[model samples]
Target chain A: AQSVTQLDSHVSVSEGTPVLLRCNYSSSYSPSLFWYVQHPNKGLQLLLKYTSAATLVKGINGFEAEFKKSETSFHLTKPSAHMSDAAEYFCVVSDRFSGYSTLTFGKGTMLLVSP
Target chain B: EPEVTQTPSHQVTQMGQEVILRCVPISNHLYFYWYRQILGQKVEFLVSFYNNEISEKSEIFDDQFSVERPDGSNFTLKIRSTKLEDSAMYFCASSGDYEQYFGPGTRLTVT
Candidate 1:
């Protein structure tokens, strides 16, 4: 089974400051990790993915995450937090099944940005 | 840039009613999936469809739940008899390789 745990339920940061959201996972097979963001009443948008290729993956809107196998962690970070960046962020883990893969999502960390 | 789309953004129904949620995945994508997030809960996988049939399903996808690619462009998830617990934000996602793109979810509210 593949599962992810988000370390924080809510993270508050000032605009232009750094942002960090932590996640950890466990999987029986090789895993693919992803960070998805959802704005209020909006769809889940892909921020970045870690598929065993590169340890540090950059995504849209100036967000990035690093896959650390030794720590079993994939934490999202951004140099500057924007008010528009406030959203619910989910850390997801996917493991290949018979012919496909399924996403196991974390409870989610709600990022609150203050101007 | 193509993206997934879903219909009936918000649906309210009474218990035992049947609900069919529709989705149109990104064109050229080969894999489709359904997931749900109840209020204040984590997203849970429901089922995945590939090659015109179901590839895998989670335990949450009981007999009451079914998925279909009824037409060439439309993928759907149907709940035969929805319980109160079935109320959630249902998201449809499609993937060409591994990274899946999601659609605006359908809020299924069963009263």
Candidate 2:
């Protein structure tokens, strides 16, 4: 079984400040972890993924995440939050061992960026 | 850049009515999937299709839910009888490898 949990349901940050969205996962096998962002009424956009390639992964829009094996966590971070960064972010986990590589998503954390 | 596309961006239907959501995935992708997000809830995987058949499906994809690739370019999801609880955003996705590209989604509102 593979699952992910986004620690924060809502995160508020001022523009130009750092942003952090925490996620933890449980998987019986090595898992592929991803972070996706969804703007209001828009489709999910992949922000980054960790497939055991690198501990720290960089994504578009100045977003990045570090996969911590010991902590069982993949936390998204952005050095500076922009107003356009306000959106709902989801943490997803998938492992090939699962029947069809099904992706399990977290409940999502809504980020609010204020100027 | 190639991206997935979905039709009927929003649909309003009566309970028990049938609805079809259309999608055109990235041209060369082989794997297709359907997912839904209820208001204020997590995105739930409904089904995954490959090689012209269902590879896997979730409990939510009951008998009423079906998927088809009627043509080379089109992938569709059909709801035989939509219920109020079926009202949600349906997303279509396709992937060549591990990274799936998602469509904008169709908002189905069953009244």
Scored by TM-score, the top model is 2
Candidate 1 displacement at residue A87 in angstroms: 0.5
Error of 2 at A36 (Å): 0.5
lDDT of 1 at B60: 94
lDDT of 1 by residue, A12-102 (tens): 9999999999999999887888899999988999999888788999999999999989899999999999999999999999886222578
Error of 1 at B63 (Å): 1.1
Over 4 Å off in model 1, which ranges? A97-99
- Please provide TM-scores, in order, for all candidate models, with all chains considered together: 0.96, 0.97
Residue-level lDDT of model 2, residues B61-110, one tens digit each, is 99999999998899999999999999999999998867888999999999
Please write out the lDDT profile of model 1 over residues B1-111, one tens digit for every residue.
Answer: 899999999999999999999999998989999999999999998999999989889899999999999888999999999999999999999988668899999999999
Per-candidate Cα lDDT values, in order, are 0.93, 0.94
* lDDT string, candidate 2, A1-115, tens digits: 8889999999999999999999999999998999999998788999998888889999999999999999999999999999999999999999863224678999999999999
| Model 2 ranges with Cα > 4 A deviation | A97-100
lDDT of 2 at A51: 87
